[model samples]
Target: MQLTDRQNNIIAIVKNNEPISSQNIAKELGLSRTAIRSDLSLLTMLELLDAKPKVGYYLKKGKKLTNIDDLLEKPVSEFMSSPVSVEENQSIYDTTIKLFMEDVGTVFVTDTEEELTGIISRKDLLKMSIGHGNLKKTPVSLAMTRMPNIISVKKNEKFIDVLEKIVDNEIDSLPVIDNKKIVGRVSKTILLQTIMNIAKKF
Candidate 1:
């Protein structure tokens, strides 16, 4: 569920004084009772709030990243891309052409077992081949940032925290991992699209 600024503000207010009645909160915040009720229901479904018909709603306590089971259960899965990979032995020319044809900015480099070994981005290739060698001869592995060097996320990660990581790390995308296998990617485009879908009504 996407939260609007108003709903977020209500969350903050509820956090400060949880177990708050919908009527009391509506009066205090100067928002319509119907609007508060609707937002409250959505927030409850998102697990951000807990509500009891007569008892009202209370904010769920904890840091955003601390308890993510709820967030992971939502449209978060929809924002991920199937993990795409290329072999380490692949040539830069072939990789570059494929990347362009696929219109992707980066591709993960994996071993024969499909474990993530590294990541080779369009920028990585461009910078590595700028001055010296033949593009067709240069191997993608030589230009890839090794696995431990690239940032990655787990399948159950929260969308908000993942977005914060992307912005703070100044990176384009993060590979998603499951059982030591590269399962998917979470990119800026996906994040934006998810946000748009969630916020369209607001």
Candidate 2:
């Protein structure tokens, strides 16, 4: 889980002071002592910190670091990437050009309300191009891989779980779905980028 900005500031205080009370933290940050109680509770809950009744909060530096996989057992919400999408009723010709302009391997298709309905891949467009179809008259709804056929990830799914789905299915990316609506995307490229970022810490 990613730390909130306020939580980070609390950690910084505990780190620098070695053992700081919630009251002192509130005083330093100009917040009420009660305001920081939940922050301390959350830090403790995540195992980044520990506290005693009188001595106050301290970083859990003596504890062993989590296993790599455990460290990465976070939600896709932490590593979500902006998605590329097009409306389902759009002309296939315009959608094809937009696909190239967006420079994505696959573009999600949405209804007039911008709710995800399907997807159109470059391969799909290529096949259509070779068929000598009338682009201006063809609707993307006809060419798209429609609803119920779309493979998508969820906001709360473990990040690695999403990556596994991508590799096992041999797909380029999966849209991040939340309560049946598309919110973001996770591509193979984005997954690689995340791995590289984590590698830098060691």
Candidate 3:
């Protein structure tokens, strides 16, 4: 739902000048009607705008803007992303590589049974590296924040509840658990993006 800058501009133009033609909107933005054809179509599809046969485009009435409180009450399962995990016995060096390759702030640690056991963060790896110890020989379990100590969430948990935990714990991400197994991860970045997407509708 994140709109491009041009899309936002188009919405603004259409809002201020109701029943405005696509040709005029494009001219106002110094573009061609063909160039904004897709933008108009998308805005209409999102119900932010509406069109008529002979008329042009106008802001859609009667549709309520997104309510942030209601949005946060939705389940985390709807927004969680696939988790990036490493085995507990994985070497610190290899696990660090996995973190970089995954481009994630934290990595979940799993046992031989593939159940969640612990969690590791980029900060944890960096702290271990300062010792100048042999990372290849050191196991990731040595640096992980073990279960019962790790902050986590369930898939059905409310988004607002997860947001509260993240803010209270000062953590970057939480592993989504189901029957003790990691199913997904909800991160600060994802939460912020979701909120921004809703905010743009206003």
Highest-scoring model, lDDT: 3
* TM-score winner, 1 or 2: 2
How do the residues 68-99 of candidate 2 rate in per-residue lDDT, one tens digit apiece? 57536879988888888888778888988897
How well does model 1 score by local distance difference test? 0.78
Q: Which lDDT tens digits does candidate 3 get at residues 1-202?
A: 4578999899889889989999999999999999999989988888888999779899888764565877778898999999999998899999999999999999999999989999999999999999979999999999999988999999999999999999999999999999999999999999999999887865
- Give the per-residue lDDT of model 1 (tens digit) for 133-161: 88888889999999678888887777876
- Candidate 2 backbone collisions, by pair: none
Q: What TM-score goes with each of the models?
A: 0.63, 0.63, 0.69
lDDT of each: 0.78, 0.84, 0.92
- What clash pairs does model 1 have? none
All-Cα superposition RMSD per candidate? 10.6, 8.7, 10.0
> Among all windows of ten consecutive residues in candidate 2, which has the lowest summed lDDT?
62-71
Off by over 4 Å in 3: 1-66
Candidate 3 backbone overlaps, count = 0
Give the C-alpha miss distance for residue 193 in model 2, angstroms: 0.8
